[model samples]
Each structure stands twice: as C-alpha cells, then as structure tokens.
Target: MLGRGSMLVSSLFPLGVSGRRAGVLALLVWALVACRRAPEVSSDEVGEESSPAVLTIDAMDNEQHVLRGGFSVEAGVFRVELYEGSVLLGEALLEEGRWSIPWQPGVGSEFLEVVAYAMAGTEIRTRLDFQRLSFTEPEGLYAAEALLALPTEPDITTRYTLDGTAPGPSSPVYTTPLVLLNKRGQPAPLSLIPTNPDTSPETWRWKPPATPPVLATVVRLQRFSGETPVGPAEARTYLIGQGATSLPVLSLVTDAEHFFGHDQGIYVPGRMHDPSPEGTAGWGTGNYMQDGKEWERPVHVEWFEETGAPVFAQNAGVRIHGSGSAALPQKSLRLYAKEDYGPESFQADFFPGHPLRDFKRLLVRTSGQDQQNSKLKDCVLQGLLRETRLALQACRPTVVFLNGEYWGLHEVRERYDEYSLASHHGLNRKKVVILEGDGLLDTGEAEDAIPYAELLAYVREHDLSVPEHFAHVEARIDVEDFIDYHVAQLYFGNEDWPENNIKFWRHRGGSATPGAGDGRWRWLMYDLDAAFARGAEANSLGRLLRDERMAEPFVVLFRGLMTSPGFRERFVARFHWHLDNTFAPERVLARLDATVELLAPEMPQHIARWRYPESEASWRDEVQRLRDTLARRPEVMRRLLQEELGSP
Candidate 1:
C-alpha cells in the first residue's frame, strides 16, 4: 500500500512523464514520499464543535515542490504558519473553511512544514513536498526533431502550447511526448543515414536546405487532475539554429517562478501587469544560462530576450540600465563582468577580437522610446553618427529570450564608462576624467573640473569675438568634436541635449603621444532616443542657439563660439557639409531603409511578444513617421540655421 505522499506522487504520472526517463520518476516519487509525511496528532489533541480536525495539507499544484502558488488545506483552522526548517516562510488566514497563501520556496527547500492552529487552540504540523522538475532532453542546438518529456505523475493531465503563449487548462493536452520539428515537418537527418546504400543501383546524395532552419518554439506545461488544475504551468523554449549570423540570437533561461513571481521577479514591481505607481520599483536579479549551466544570482538583471543560437554567454552581474526607460515595464539592462561576482569578463566573444573584448560592461537597450513604433530611431541616429567619425558606442540588433520566453528585439550596445575609455583610447581608467553637463565629474578627481569650470567662466566673462579670448577657449576644448556633436544633436532634433544627456571625457594630464593627453574635452555621443520627431514642430536648433535661458555650460560655449567670425564660418560650413552629405534625404533615408530591412522580419515577433503594436501595419506606420522626419528634418534645420545664424 502507498503512503499518502506516495499516492500524491502517483497522481502526477498522468501529467505526462510516463513513457520517458524512468530514473527521474523514481527519484521524484521517493522525494515526494519522503518529504510529505502526515501531520503529528497529539493524544490530547481533539476538535471542539466549533473547530474541525486538520485533515490534510497539499500543494495546489502537484507538478513541482517549489511552491509559488496557493495551497489547499482540509482543515477548519483559523491560521497557518509555513516554515523551512526553523525559519518561518509565511502565514495565512483562513476564511470560511479555505485558506490561500502565496509562497516562494528557497533553493534546496526539500520539505516545508505547515503548522496549523484550529479555532479550538489545537495545533497540528504537516510537511509539504517539493521536487525540481527536470527537462529529460537537454535544451540546446538541435539538428533533428527534439523530444520533450517530464517525469510521470499519475492521474494528472499536462496541457501545453507552442505559440509563445502561456499554457492554461484550455491549452492542448499532452498525451504523447512532444516532438519539435523543423519547418519541413520532417525529422532532422541523422548522421548514420547512408548516402549510398550497398544495394542501391545508383549513387545517392543528400542536399540540405539552402537556409539553415530557425525554430523558436516556446513550450509551456500545466498539470491537471480530471477537471481541476493541479499545479502552476512550467514553460521552456527550444531554439535550434545552425550558427550565429549577422543578427545573433541570445537564449536566456532561468527558473520560471523567479522570473515571473509576484514579489521577487523583475516584472513584479511596476512593469509587466501591475498598473500601480508603486510597482515601478521592479528591478530584481536572476541566473543567466549559458553553455548548458545556471550562472546563479545577485547579478542584477532585467529580462527581455527569448530565441536563437547563443554566441555569447556569461555569468556576469547585470542591472536595470536606463534612466528614462527604466520606469517602463520593458526596461533596458546592463551586464557587468567583475571579480566580485565570480567572473572577470562576460566569457563569450561578443565582439570577437575587437577592442570591445577587454570591456566588462554591456547594454541591452529596448529602444523603449520608440518601442511602440519604428524601433529604429536610435539605431539610425547612431549609424549616422558613426559615419561622421564621431566617437560613439557600437550597436547590434539581437533577439532576446528571458528564461526561454520570447522577450522581443533588443540592441546590444557598448556602455560608455571608464572601461570604454580604456578599451577605445588605450587610457588608464584611474587617470581618465569624464564630465557630463556643466562640468560635473563622473570619474577622476573632482578638482579636475576646475579647468573646465574656468573655461566656462571665461566664456561668460570675456568677449569670445576677440580672437585672443576665442583662441584661449579653443585651447581648452576639442573644437571639431564639439561641432560634430552639436550638429548631430540639432539635426536629429534631440530635445534632451546641452542640458541633458551630454557627456565629455578627457585625460587628466598631457600625454607623450601627439593629441593623446591634450587635456582637451571631447564629447561622446550617447542616448539619442528623443530624436526624429514625426510631426511638424518648431525646430530646437534655432531656439537652442539663440535662447539665453538655456544656460547650460555647453550651450554657453556654443553661443560664445558663434560670436566669433572665424568660429561662425567654420560652424556654418560644417553644418552645411553634413546637411548636403550625412543628413541629406537620400543618404538618411537609405540608412533608415537598410536598418528597417534588417529589423522588419523580426519586428512582428517582437511586437507579438511585447504587444508594442496592434499589428505590423501599426509598426510600419511608426516607421513611416521616422521616414517623414528624416526626409523633412534637413530642410527644417537649414531654414532654422539661416534664420538664426544668417544664410550660409
């Protein structure tokens, strides 16, 4: 005869693991039987007329032992306390004979104790069972049909879905093991298949498909007992591909409950489904999967990726990475590779033999500003910036997965910091001085700002129209970089500029190499998310150049430079050169179209996952808005420039 716990384990076989691995089943059964002993009833323990006996305690979902859902208790108890060993996990209040409590089981919490106190002041203790679900077939690159099976539990039905939707009681029920096929609806050819059979009269050859098969399938499973659901649904995505292409696919897998739990997951705070203002604090950490192993946690991260062959994998630290977009449910992320977190580098070759290899930080940008539409604005602007030879971060479009669930499209970007300066310019991290708007020092000594502050003070005090004072100001800064930076910002109509998102860096002292340690401030192009307005509005170029209220130090420098005849001539000539070349409609639109082509195929999948648009048509409408801005922005700027600084 089976113990009560053994009977519970036997009840889960119907949840779809019977024909698969036998060892997993035996282990799970043994675990459940050993952990779920019945409550101890004292000899004096008795129920009064007002209080019923504490009958049974069971996990509402019998699929896995990690409790992330409500539990059903057959007790007329008023209160229940749950514990892991001696530590109290949670407590619940019974209402009208039923109690529901939300609990997150800790790692290695094999058995949980549930202590119930009846209305009659009698207490009984029972143990709740737990077992980690195992994916019988490993998740990775597959050339043939992949088999997916779970350990069998009797009297339970498993329902599943493959369309990236969460599985529910109404989803397709699994009767046989799941077989994932390629696009051709055939099994991937095995290596043992003979190209030429011994008995064949003619020579035979096999030809593979021209394009490698790309399969992004998300499988979610829920267990059920007859008409009632037994446990919470578990899901995983199987991404199979030949190799990394121009657009690499990143596959991230972690525990489902940890990624989606109500209290602990990244989506729990203010993003995802919660609509309250308080939910905005939704930053959390989770394990990053790479090379077929779990990386563990305390590396803060925000999930938004779901498929393709993983080229780069790391067990590095991560954090929610944007200032403006961080509040959005679909937030950006920053990954760090540091000694404190166990890894000193992100491991996989993200850039592969590039200068970026030595850098330890990376950005996963959602393009959230334009997420509802084109999703190409920032990429397009950065591409143009690179063409003009301005120092800026590099970007690559990638599809991201969060714990095997499709997160949508993200741009892998280079983060600008001490590491970036060291990698790109071959400078010492400790000696580099990075300053934002108004000479606010981000790195190096706070005293380093004295020179920049003096320059700003000189621009305010002296007449820059005087060649001597203008020359003095020019010596303190990189004139050409400042011009290009301002041109790019004005052309893009980026409203967050001069006063916001501006960054410049310089070495602390003079260098032995020519132009290396000039101590002159050079701007770094970044955060162009607020550019390329879709509608006709007054251009910011004219207003910023002429507005006295916009007294940001950078703005003051630009205005002071415009006061000089030589400076104005160079600025105007540079502006027109960019207008006719870089920002020209043909050139700009060509770049935009090329980006759109690369991103179009993946946009629908991204949209489907994030609900960023009602349909692809809506997405394209946003793209058209960007196109219109690119086509008309140059003329608008030219007109604004002529009006503000006189005809070039």
Candidate 2:
C-alpha cells in the first residue's frame, strides 16, 4: 500500500537554550544594579549558585522546530527584557505566568538574553536560567528534482536547486547531478536511472527496492471472543512490511483510525467497499452532482474498486469447514503467540512533516481538470471571512480548508457583500482561521506542468487570508485539523463539473479567461490535435485546482461551491470548445475524454478493467447528449471545439 516515497522518522537536532542562559545572567546583573529596589533575593533560596535559566534547542525534525520549554513564575508586575548584543529589542510582561517567543534568525548566528525583576511590594521568587537553540532545514537542502521521460529523449542538463534558475553547464560543477525516469518510462537505452538509492544517515539515498518485498511476516498474536476472550478463539493476524507487496486492491477507504496500515494503516482490499456495491463512490448524499435526481448506484470505477484498496492476510489457522457454514468444531486459541513483524516501524503513504494529522476540522477539496492556469481558487478560499467566524464559534480556535487556488485573503470582504455563503458575520472583523495550501500547483511548476504567471501573482498578494498556498498545517495557530481530498479524482472529465466547481467555490460571478492565443502555436502547451500537430501531456486532476486563475469575486463563490461534494461546476467553455472543433462521435465525449486524461497517466496499467458495461453506458449516454446538442445548432460541437481546443 505504501507508494513511491516512504516516511521514515529519520533523525533530530539539538535544542539550544543559550538564550535562557543570557536572560538569567542579565536579571542577576539588574538585581545587583538596583540596590534599593532589590527585594531580598538570595541565590541560595532557589538552590542555585547564582546562575540564570539555561535554554538549549535541538531539531529532531525540521517541521517541529519551536519548543515550549522555559519555566514561568507566579503572576507579577515584572518587566522582562530581552537582548541579543547591544540591541535592546523588546520587553514582555509576566501577567499570566507564561512567556513565549518564536525564533527567527537574521543574518548570522544569534544569541538571546532576558532580564527579569519584580515590581513594588512584590518580592523576587525563583528564576529560570539560560537556554541554547540551533536551527536547520534538512529537507529543504535534500529536496531533489527528477525529470519525467519524454517521447523524444529530453536533452539532459546539470543544474542545482529548484529556485526558478535555468540549467547550467554539466561541467565546471563540483557536484554530481542526477537524472531520473520512472520504471514504466525506462526504455532500453536510458535504463540507468536511480530506481532505488541507499539512504543512510550521512547521505540518505531513497531508491525503490530491486526485488519484490517480503510483506509483513504473518504473526498470530492474542485472540478474541465477543470482543474479549475468556479463552482463545481467533488469533490477531497481520502482515509486516519487508520489501513490497503486489496484492489485488479490492477497494479502499480513508479515516484517522488506520494509518494506511503501518500502524493500523488503511490500505487493503476487501477493506475498501462501496457499501451498496452500487452505492456512491464518495461520501455524502448521493445527488451531489446531478440536479434533480440522486444517483441510485455509485458510479462503478475500475481502479477505485480494483487496485485502490488493501488486502490483509488474516487469521489463517482458523480452519473453515468445507461447504457448510452452520457450525464448526471450535478450539481454544493460542494466547501467547506474539509474532514480531521484523521492525517496530514500517511505511505508510505519509508525507514528511505530514498534514491531515488533525482530521476533525474542515477538509475541503477541488475538482477542476487544471483547465485554468491561476491560483484564483486558492485565494478565494483564503478570502473566506465567515469561515473563520464559524470555526471560532464552534469553540475551535481557527478554521482550515484544503487551499484550492493561489491567492490572498482580501476577497472575503471584497466579494462577500454581493455573494456571501456565510450567514452570521458582520463587516470589518473575522476570525483568523489558518490557511495551509496543499493541493495542486501551490508554487512554481515543472516539466509538462509549467505554473502560469497569473498563479504567481495571486500567490504573491499579502492582503489575502492565507499568507502562502504551498504549505499545509505546521504552526499552532494554523488549522486545528488537516485533511486531504481522497476523492479528488472525481472532479475530472465531468462535462462541466470542473468549471462548475470553480464557479461554485468562487461565488460564480466572474467570467473565465479565454485560453485562446491564436492557433499558430498548435502544439505549444497542451495536447491539442491541430492540423499542424497533436499532443497529450500528463494533464490530470492536479491541474484542475491550479486552473482557478479567473478574475476575482467569481473565483470566490467558485471556491466555496467546490468545497462541497456535489461538484456542480460545469465547464461550458471546454464543452463548447470541443463542439466547435468538429469532434467526431468518439471525440465529442468531453466527460470521457477528460476522465481519460485524468486517469490515463496514473492508471495506464488498469485501463483494461475500466471497460465495464456501466462505463460504456455512461459514455454512450454522454455521447448521445453531445450529438443531440450539436444536432440542434450549426455544427455546435465541431465549431466550438475547433476554435477553443485549437487555440493556444
């Protein structure tokens, strides 16, 4: 169940408390200086040898840097002063017996000092000492870029960093540059790509295993009967991870209970169920998209049902009587058969500095086909003022959302007067819900997916609610809960769903930008099949959320609407564009084409199973709808498709 990247606890840095050291020392000096004001404070009272509080900082991980360490005294009207060198930067009050400050280094190495003293009528009590802290960004330095293979072998280049810098000469560089191609893309000529790299402490090399992994070693541990057992009945069964397993994925579901199977992780077949077999593919009331009618049976998808779920090797010793199920010879279970799964730690699809740890708050998702090329959707979400209020009212400190586009928090006030989905909030003030952008192109682009310049602008705006769109929860005041869009793939290829989704989230008033740049550069970006050339890149659902770069307020409600599961946004332009392009009976299916576009790259191996009767039925129904719509106007489908799809 663990995919490409594996999550390892990996390593830690020292907690530096030097600042505390300086603070305590300064306070001693101050007490000595104020001879008359000094209130009988002796070093022997606190059982210390006139030493100040000491502070030390260590980073076990880059994400969890800040630490809550110092000891606080009783509430007193005392002035606590802090200094680095000659700079008398700031002072704080000891009001509620708590003091906290974030560490942000400027220029070179930093040393902090704190001075504390009591007010009139109050005597000095025990004081805290010095602290030492160190800071570093391991992941930042280790992050490497990989190149996906091209139909025509891409010219290899050597460069360092992903900071929008162009590739430089492979020579004159002291470091060895690495290039990569996926297992599927490994042709005979360029098969030297790193599949598996040995990752150790000094130099971590992350490479896929060369041979099949010995999945979890089966171990029978404990037994259960009626939730508890006087005796033994069935032993607990589990498969540990050694290498990797290639099991048929029956179905899959997500929840906080299982950590994707590593520690009660959630990825196994038979575990993933549609509930009704014909039930909805996702959560919520079934009529999420279709207007008047609710779907009786959930759309049957192949990958979702086949290779998406997990499979477990369960209670193997429980001998099943052949044929009959009425009764069986029950035996006592082996109570103390605890089998070790090799290692205490294993792998799940966990992200480094993972989000979604707090799964209770709001977990929203987007479903565009990356048709648009801006971060408007992200900004529109950050602009939600009422959301902050609602979250605060629920007793939750701050609100959170799966950031869709790449913009700031200004639009909440700008657009709400006209189309506010939120009810109980006045102007001028809103709660500060933490916004962490996780999905799609949160930042710059790469390869076939080049981030549009428009996305960069929306991301740059500081007046917006979210400061940035490329991050998820890491700060305390940030979102309380962090969740991901498990069913994000549903947004693709649904006639106008992607458009409708953006429209709904954005409040739907603004118009979409025309993606046309004349038909001259036919094979420029997307896979347009013009008379000049034909192309299809790895366009998927990710590009869907990235396409929210519409003009303001429109992107507002559009973001909010898509936060829901209904997915009502429709792509009128793309639908019309396809029609104008003289799309044949087969090519007229935008829904099908879009679905194919989204699923094809990731699901090339499973496309054969997608040819079920239900899928064909959906295709035919959509095809007829297209044909009949076109039959009504002047080559409606053809003209529109040719005009838009053919444009740059």
Best by TM-score: 1
Q: Which stretches of candidate 2 lie over 4 Å from their true place?
A: 1-349, 353-356, 360-499, 503-648
Give the per-residue lDDT of model 1 (tens digit) for 552-588.
Answer: 6668888888899998888889999999998889988
- Candidate 1 lDDT score at position 383: 82
Measured against the true structure, the TM-scores of the candidates, in listed sequence, are 0.60, 0.18
Model 2 TM-score, 2 decimals: 0.18
lDDT of 2 by residue, 283-325 (tens): 2111121111111111100011122232221111111111110
Worst 10 residues of 2 by lDDT: 400-409
How far does residue 221 in candidate 1 sit from its true spot (Å)?
21
Which candidate tops lDDT?
Answer: 1
In each prediction, how many residue pairs overlap at the backbone (N, C-alpha, C within less than 3 A)?
24, 121
